[model samples]
Target: MNKFLFKVSFIILFLFLGTAKTFAQKLKFLIPDAGIVQHAGSIGYFSVGAGYEIFKNKKGYLDFNYGYVPAFKGGELHAVTVKLAYKPFEIKLSDWAKLYPFNPGFFLSYTFQEDLAYKFHSSEYPRGYYYWSPALRPHLSFSNEIELSIPESWDGLGINKIGLYTEFNTNDFYIVNYLQNTSSLSLSDIFQLGIGVRLKF
Candidate 1:
């Protein structure tokens, strides 16, 4: 179970920016903490995987991602995520900051995820848990994402958008009866902070 993630990504586009024909595409490896909300303390495993992004003058764009739980520390939680993004407007933000801003690109988004949660019975193991919200659905969900970019651009090393890229999303978790016994909000808070590198064009 040493496998953490397996994914391939690409950015395709159609555009008439009026200045010239330009295309943008990006691929990234991401780690999703699908099993984070189950933890009592902050002691938990990290998420890792890859992703792809394509932006055409910030007008038309598409993104997709997939990930797996690490076997070294995360052998029971097997998760995969796929997302689609389409932007119809232009937004801007900071580029180089340790703490990322509270904004992102893309006006609307659709996401579908499949996670195989791992259950441990050993007392030596921490109580395994999941991150589920709205606690009212059939375990499947659709979410929305807001984009926040760099505050300023440097030479070209992506020094501004590195270390931790934050995205405030919905916490969609699933358990045998855990979330079903929680709150009844339409959406939950999802704070994704992972380690990775970012590149800009």
Candidate 2:
């Protein structure tokens, strides 16, 4: 199953890259931006993905990510996620540093190799036994980001901007459970921490 998932991911990535390349010449600015991520809200140990900034000033963005979970951490899982985010404001702190004080986003993820029974009900079970599919997870997050613009001297390296970000995230299922048991569940109990970096070209 792991091998099958790897192959599917590879094929999807290949097709996306090919399509992006074909349209890049006509839509240079619309080409996807690539990045790597680590430890994102317990969704996976790590992930790599691409995103596109929308509008002339890039106030909105959309991303797609592929993540991996090791066998020891719930027996090998592959997650594919689609996210949309909006940056409300940007502050120029200095010549080198700029800050996006708030970025709120939502994501939907599908996990492959997950237990099918958890996602779907058996025929023997009555209707509405489970309200949500385990394979499909929805999350909401808010992030704070600081970006550094590279100087001309570093232009040779082909890197333009570096961003450091941290996010607080929670899933819909967790939130639902927390709401039902508000007296027992604290806000912190439903949230998770994610940290990562982004390099922009």
- Can you write out model 1's per-residue Cα lDDT over 43-89, one digit (the tens) per residue? 12333333344454543223332333345753533333343334343
- The model with the greatest TM-score is 2
Model 2 segments more than 4 A misplaced: 1-24, 27-30, 117-119
Winning candidate number (lDDT): 2
Candidate 2 whole-model C-alpha lDDT, 0 to 1: 0.82
Clashes of each: 24, 0
Clashing pairs in 2: none
Name the regions of candidate 1 deviating beyond 4 angstroms.
Answer: 1-55, 59-62, 72-78, 85-100, 104-164, 173-195
**Poorest lDDT segment (10 consecutive residues) of candidate 1:** 33-42
